[model samples]
Target chain A: MTKRGRSIRVPVLARVEGEGALEIDIAGNRITRLDLRIYEPPRLFEKFLEGRSYLEVPDMVARICGICPVAYQMSAVAAIEDAFGFTPGPELRAWRRLLYCGEWIESHALHIHLLAAPDVLGFESVLDMAQAWPEVVERGLRLQALGNRILAVLGGRSVHPVSVRPGGFSRLPGPEALDPLQEACRAALETARDLVAWTASLDLPRETQDFPCVALRHPHEYPMNEGRIAATTGLEIPVSEFEAHFEEYQVPHSTALHSRLAGRSYLVGPLARLNLNRDRLPPPVAEALAATGIAFPSHNSHFSIVARAVEIFLALSEAVRILDDPPPAAPALARPLQPRAAEGFGCTEAPRGILYHRYRFDADGRVQAARITPPTSQNQARMEEDARLALERFGLDRPDEELRRYAERVIRNYDPCISCATHFLRLKVNRR
Target chain B: MTTIRIIGLGSPFGADRIGLLAARRLAREVRLPPGVEVIERDRPGLRLLEDFTGARAVLLLDALAGGIPGRVREVERSALLARAAPLSSHALGVAEALALAEALGRLPEAVGLLGVETGPAPGPEDVDPVWVQALCLRVPVALERLVPDRRVAGCGGRIRSRR
Candidate 1:
């Protein structure tokens, strides 16, 4: 018995959402071991937010991840607003929903067109894909740009745009500022329809997985800003009861904390949402998704690209509707947080999936403990399993080039954002 | 005869990856007296080390995007080693693929830095005005170090913040 090839391990991965690794033991059968670790140090916003002024929660906890800054902002604002006990006015809610739409559009497009699509199309990186499938890459850039444009119009620059506070936005976008967004949203809706159709047209392998679906469930609309945590197995609970239902276990083999529902593991994000609330999707978006020939409860993880494309259409359609009647000028926030020892739960549908944050603030505002559960962290285990499943399904006898793409596909489904400690995405600073 | 390899970090299309562009300009100005090689390796790989073997020194240039905007980190090999393992795997990023070189102890003797700060702007792909400006100031320093008495005019906008 000979110990085959060298064992390689990545303790921390780059160009991703959080830390993860790939280790392979190639004997007769290549042991493709992939662990999507969430290496982000726990800041414990939940314990820290125990007694602090609730208002400071947004700014303080927003540092969790750059990719979904607004998600954090929205969750903190909504929860704190819930505690202080006031719902944002109808107009404010519409504006908040609009901002969320931009995040979904941008993040979903990024995952689909840039990260995942390249892998499916037989390219190592998007840069490689750009040479052969120029049109596809262009479409991604255009769609991503549209998403970015929406963020900029409402908030500022797409990455960590400054807008949306507890009560509302920092400063409401002027009517004209929203006008171009309206136009862009209208055009993007059509673009998204085409994108979804195009994505469905790809030859996707099928798998039948019975993983429990986890997502926020809304009565009237698709989940985004607020809803109870619901499972496809008929389990529904408030976000505060999240811990009661799910537990995060620390594994020495990986950086990310693995999550499980009580005694079982579950899946979330795009697939989960579509499965749970396909009927709630807007008419146009739903029709576009159906046109893609994809159905709900799609166990094939690769179908996430189709799910993302469908969400992009929903985002565009929603954005246009919001822009049709912009929220009037109003102070971005409400009264400063009232300080009292308390625990508050916040959750939102990030572009990737459900991002949960719990803030326990001391009487003043010093963060006592913060638990920021990013969507990527939750998806880590599933990603690793997907990689192994892909290898087993495809047979490791195939070339690394072909197998590697599917490996990347598993990772892309989580839309891993390696920087969960910091709340921004795709930041490149140039000081000349 | 020493060889220098300039591997571009970050997505070239991204608003980062300007470090590669700066390294390219420096490679043009600081030609070896006789036996020297320049390589613009894109992305990450183990083959990048083939250029620096038996060389007196190597300068790895790339982009860094963090902190108070216009700040440069003159990182030493040791500083990078603390981040990486066995000192050799720190070629590109420690968190990425490195254990291959670390076990071999095949690290270059001398390593230099030409890291340029990119402050939330468009990065260098074909060419960018912002990256070219920073390179103008840093390129001369690089050439002076590699080839003494060699001089080259800086191009890209009027030079300022020359650190």
Candidate 2:
């Protein structure tokens, strides 16, 4: 008698930021196929962006994902400014960096506490983890709030901020605003430090892969809104040169386009950023990283949590540094803009990873075309690779439920923003 | 510390804009009591806790899908969390946030989700006008329910009532 077709399926990927699924198939103790599917449906954000005024692009693109709206806004503003040959003054740039720090802290905190930690601790959800570790959950909430506080001060509110534009912000916060934000950050520093320590203490599973890592590289500081795209494989390219070397091809299984560099999958996000810029971290964060006893350039994706925690520490320190020297009380908005027909590219390191945006503008500054490549879409191919590798390493004969959970763990390790990967798919494993 | 926070939740696109529209209408049509703060949000998700923290009460207005078009429903937090799955595609949604708040003990003394049914409307304008009017009419009623002429200990030891 022949074994019938058997497969494992996760119809709805849970504990993730967006919608996705997973499926695997095995026959006679051998895994046949693994599909890391992201079927969230195409949002047509690129199409929607066309014909919109350049001024509205920042706010409009921010809606791409609630978790990292700032990333979209930052990339949009940068690209638009690039097209117009404008760069913000040092103070304005620092403010943008500070805002980016807030997003990192907030987004990373949410992932560490709510999404990833539960899997490491063997709980179903953060709510479940709270039952036994209330204090841990409380600290996470406080830290999350601290991150939001920074955004509220800088962006005007946490989500879909109304302040950003092509040239500069709508308004600049003065010393008075800076005082409270600084004070609040000061209070939260201890928690941020403790959170890093706590994350590092988790018994992380070690599964190292030799995949190439990529992120933004800046000479003087960690990359956020501005930097050259660097890869561990010794590839360095300006943001403008992104399309020249990399490609995003549509797969029938996913709404998101699978991205590759020189026709091969690469990893991005926290792990990649840390791998590329460990030495550039602030001294305090560097000290914290050393204390964790984890080696630098960790190949284990599980260490991504540590990368995020380290980022939170760095963001907090940077937030304090920026706040201490508040911008002048002069009007916060940048000089009036003069929009002209142009094409531009913007790339930034979101909390999750690198986000890229390209836009073409009509003579009147209306968007003629737009292309956005979110971090998650770039990570999709790598995620599928990891799932297959996990099954191979963990054993194909494991119980179906156990394998499913393990796959979910691997997927969540990337902290995928399925909404951002609107071009996502469902997962399925097929047995021969 | 603010005693009352009214948060209108939704995006600005299509039918999802109702929460924001209703919020703006309430802000203009009704006079807020001294301690109440009205805010508009584009899907704050788990950040709802941050918005509602330290408040004595919270009234969340949102455009709800999968119900009668233009119908309004006032739901208790407990009922909402009982089926605590995400209602939106973009974020964790209100139910999961409320559940997290409940588990963390950060919930206010009173919380209500004012759901305005979007029905089959394609866009903001397509939604029945009656839904908007109903939301406006229910704002005061919800406020009264939150405060209700009672002094509750969870309200930070302040004696509070609606004007």
Chain A alone, TM-score for each of the models? 0.86, 0.92
Q: Give the TM-score of each candidate.
A: 0.68, 0.86
lDDT of 2 by residue, A260-366 (tens): 99878899999999999998998888999999999989888989999999999999999999888876534446676778899989999988799999999988999
Q: Write the per-residue lDDT of candidate 1 for residues A1-432, one digit (tens) a residue.
A: 111100001111232334344554445554534444445533343544554555556754554554566787888777666654456777777878888888787767656765676657866444456567767755765676677667777776565566666666766668678777788678766678898889899877675555777889988888899999998889999898988888898877665688888666677888889888898998888888777766677877778878888888887888888788766666334445465556667788987788887766555644566677777767767766676666776777776555554555555566666421111222111111
Best by DockQ: 2
Q: Against the true structure, candidate 1 has what lDDT?
A: 0.62
Each predicted complex: what DockQ? 0.04, 0.22
CAPRI grade, predicted model 1: incorrect
After superposition, the stretches of candidate 2 with alpha carbons farther than 4 Å from their true spots are A1-18, A27-30, A39-43, A329-332, A337-341, A419-427, B1-42, B51-62, B86-89, B108-116, B121-163
Model 2 DockQ, alpha carbons vs. true complex: 0.22
TM-score winner: 2
TM-score, A chain, model 2: 0.92
